[model samples]
Target: MGRNTRKRRMPLATKIVAGAAALTVGGGGLVWANFYASAHEDHSGHNRTRSAAAQVATIDCPDVGQKIRDVPDRARGEVDGELATMDSQITNAYQRLATTRRAQAGDAQFVQNSILGPLKDRRKAIIDRIQLEINRAGGKADDNLDELAACQGRPADQMQNGDGQNGDGQMDDGQNQGGDGGDGNGVAGPVADDFVDINDVQPNTRDSRNGLAADGDGGSTGTFTTDCGVNENNLFNSDNLIAAPGVDNGAHHTHDYVGNQDNDAFSSDEDLANADTSCQNQGDKSTYYWPVLRLQDGTQEFDANDQGGGAEGNIGKILKPAEAQIRFVGSRQGDVVAMPKFLRIITGDAKSFTNGDANANTSWSCSGFEDRQVTDKYPLCPDGSQVLRTVNFQSCWDGQNIDSANHRDHMAFVQEDGSCANGFQAVPQLQIRLAYDIPTPTVENGQVQNPYAVDSFPEQLHKPITDHNDFINVMDEDLMNEVVDCINRGEDCQ
Candidate 1:
């Protein structure tokens, strides 16, 4: 119950293993007396043999294992064809996950609605036909569907620990010993162990005097927080949803969008300017978005997908930050420059990140219930506080353009010493800080695993690598000017 419910993507369609003939076709149930469920796993741990005889590979999806060739020669193609279709469906899921950074939350129910749903129904239909063909040919169709779905392979222990082997890849001899973990042979095989304990993965332990300029409200004369507004929990409010604004679900992934409701792939500043809002403030009309991270409770994940939370602390089943802190962080005598309309800006690539080093301008920490804030590895929040993802965008603009060729050229991160680079003029600095009420990542065999997960770029996150954010400014002419003036005058407001 503590794992994120994000399912892995398959570049091709996959199918859940059929649970042996329920024979619900007409009425009565017909039991498969040929095979027993427990026999699916051989006591000797030689699954290859058992797997070879099995029709389904895994419970979650039918493994592309051996084809059933025992059927009459004419019927073999039909069975093979059904499996091929399943593969294609699985591929579609993979494409969705790759582009959108998340899988459908319906789980078995989701499987029933989308491509998986049809796949399963078709598979059942095909199996029924196959059984009929066998009966017509005076043969028996030994059912093995129960075994197929029995081992869905979602458990952490089985995933990291192949079959039942220990960290060394060798079958556990009861000692559970872990050495340098690699086989003595110098083959480029998987390391015996690659995961780190949650406590061992502390990426940020800096006490104070951190290099970030936006770390405090030093010169802020006031702070303005938009309302917790509506939470868009359902995936893809628009066709071009998630990241890649104006592109219409271009990313193919899903995210928890906050702030302005008009934000989308094609939303223009004019759209935000005209849209009504849920926030208490009538002036804040900016749109914000990031991947939805969810915690899985062992067998399944219960998230906003099952409920309604298109608002703060609701979408992705995540609690909203106490307040969204908008600030100006940079030099130039605290003078804030008015942000141009329809400014499209992105910080950190959703599909890219570094576990050992932050490949982007990202920050992480925990607070509220937890005592410490992490800057490196995301905090395994302790006690009351939630983990926070803090991103401070480059405030030094090129003076004329709201965006650059890569959407980054116009702005540059302050120098290592926190000063604007030459030739770049300081503007009303924008800082984005999001907090999540997530527990300390689950500890399984020394590695950190989130109860929920995000769709990120890396093949494997090692930890929770789905932290990212997207923003577009839609402030009104007068309101934009006020934010700039407050920052430029170095007035602190809250």
Candidate 2:
């Protein structure tokens, strides 16, 4: 058969699903993603620009070799040395290729034949060495490097073209797989090479103070006030916070619990009703949750790989604000009106990690400093400062529904002019400003632990700025009454 006829004669299933990925939900709402993309260079034996070459099909190569600890101590040094050399080689080669692409002057074919081709070969070689190291450490190495090493460290089936999807510098969808960025994985990798070398990160700036301070020296928090303080009872650490309110392990990510510390996947309205609160009033049992913003308290870097899975939906770290301001604007209005109890709400996009950029609602700044902002990756704050994350949520409510199908329909942000958007009805605006004292990793009892790290879901590595939060109001009837009275009267209450 002719080549075109032969291609058309391929398997029916493969032909039906071929292209970039789009998620599908089954009857049970379980996510089913169909991803089909070429995993290797197109080789139609035609001497043309690789970009114009006809595309081919390939299977995904799942990752391997993260079980670095399994490598025996004796083999570790050799393995480390080999991997380090590979890192340097690939990074340097890509650096040059990227420079060529930018200049738009180098012969693309020449660069590919001379530089890119060799770099890809080096990448192939890395798989064997990585597997050897893993096996030497008494761990099993994946039999195939297609998913792990394909595209030279980029995730197996991600969109490559500069469709503005990931920061991966690939031009459109059908170009060289090794786009720019560190190792082409959207990660800067562990500060392995830069450790002890650089003294500061880019866009570093000084911080200001919260206007909500009792002294009122800084930004304004409006009328919102709380008795919740920092402590084990008010603020607890939990790794598995159920995603949906009543479903266990639903979140698949870790979160810091503030206020009602007894919260978990199975926590019910009654459970919260009877639970003791860390709020000073003792009657304010509201529960607040957000992905933990771990501080780098030690020398080691805590990564998404350690305990959390590295899958895309599993969750990664690093969520930041899309803009450069902090806002606390509106709430419901009326006399003697009370918020619907047990209301559930979530703000900020949860898919920021996979989307490759934080939504505008997400914001970040260095602790003690407010002039700078960071996204895409965690900011390496100055030596003694901490990473401060400020995430704001919607304040306006539908005034009738406690929650919606998506849990957010009942709540909304203020209007562009700072007026309540959902309706004239108002409620308290909720926002959380987290302060992280990022410390270097330290050795505890001879075991090294990463101090500045977050706990999220598994499956895909996460950056720090993908910060998320959850809240459930368990306010007493009296306190809710007081809040309603104060807001209706247009008086700020602490």
Candidate 3:
């Protein structure tokens, strides 16, 4: 496929709230709504006779990893293991909560006592161990880490539910009144309100202040493209070597990988360096992977019964991308430098649903309507326009480390002026554009038909805000220098 070298930056919005309804009829045919109400909303003098008590839509836990900024290299292995344990704990808790709805209806405190309370204890111990590891390695652990152990049940009203027709033709009251066919794991999210017609979105201007700056007159405006074929090899896995190394099912969601062939929970830097490449240019052996998009048409995929697949609330037939365009572009401030070997960069957050949009760097839009992008809602593209997922990796390196305790401090995005911050170096920014030809999903009667969603943690409920991408620089030193030189000289090369 031909490549588009034009600069198409993916702008992460401050916050995008897609409207969705979470209505369920529990045992005894009692109608309940998953109303995620505002924190300060008053329920005084309100009539509650007709409605069953509001139910907890999902679990909300503090992202402990995002909070931990410093950990001794010696203790990183222990810390990462503990973090992965926390994730599994959440998953198990969510699974229990999802499967025990009938018992929950009988006892109001079932969720709090049996689920949240026990989960808190488990997480607290995990946090304590994480602290001990840091302290043992001569690094001070954050005292507030223990405070993040408590998790709360998110009320359904907090989720943005649009006023639309319910299954019975009743207008949605922003509360739970309609039924949605969730991924069949009690995590019914990305409902009708989660998808908006692309034509309905207004054309938006690129917010240069929040995105990669456009090429300027004196800057290195050249580009280098690498033809990494779409992952036709079916190289799928649920492991995230960068985030949760040495742990199986670290991601807890399936990912489609291209470029590097040997990527999993156990791959070391040397393993990746020696792996074969899918890129046309054999010199580019870097790994690029992201959560696979699935059409919720009820087709049983290979992982339908597996840990990170249907069993964990990630369902539907996986769709392979038609185009995987990996390109390296010059910085707008000055000449770019070579990215260090084995440098890891993760753009966007996979837990932005409960964690908030502070780290969310998603750009979901239609192929033809790339300018009208969204960070939360999935775009319902027209027949010919394909769904597009584009991300721009951090273009500034801290100059000292290729990896960090949180995997983020080592890399940084360029400032609004297109210059690296003090003590950071400018490097060729990696922009990955993924395109998929998915059938447009239909939303009617507040029910989505053939809904498509990206794989996410069960607690995330398949939110688009949870979309993210990962990359690891494994390019040989010679090729890396050539990439930098090509960009600095303002010449487009392949």
Number of clashes recorded per candidate? 67, 58, 12
lDDT of 2: 0.41
Q: Which candidate wins on TM-score?
A: 3
Off by over 4 Å in 2: 1-222, 234-243, 295-337, 355-360, 422-424, 440-453, 487-493
Q: Rate the local accuracy (lDDT) of all candidates.
A: 0.40, 0.41, 0.74
Instruction: Give the per-residue lDDT of model 2 (tens digit) for 161-237.
Output: 11111222222232221222111122212222212211343444322111111112222223546756544432322
Residue range 64-123, candidate 1, lDDT tens digits:
222233454444334444444443333333222212101221132332354334545655
Q: Flag regions of model 1 displaced more than 4 Å.
A: 1-211, 214-243, 298-323, 330-334, 353-359, 368-376, 446-450, 457-466
The global Cα lDDT (0 to 1) of model 3 is 0.74
Instruction: Give the winner by lDDT.
Output: 3
Candidate 3 has its poorest 10 consecutive residues by lDDT at: 12-21
Superior candidate under lDDT, 1 versus 3: 3
Clash number for model 3? Answer: 12
Instruction: Please write out the lDDT profile of model 3 over residues 1-494, one tens digit for every residue.
Output: 11112222211110010000012222111122223221113344554322324447679999999889789999998898889888888877776665454466457788899999999999999999999999999999999899999999876553323212233223233233233444222235566778889888878853211257435676898888988798877788777899988777778789998899888878889989999989889998999999999886556677765556766667667888898888998888888878889999988899989998877888888987988878788999999999998788889998888899988889888887889987899889988888999989877766566778899987897898899999999999999999889989999899
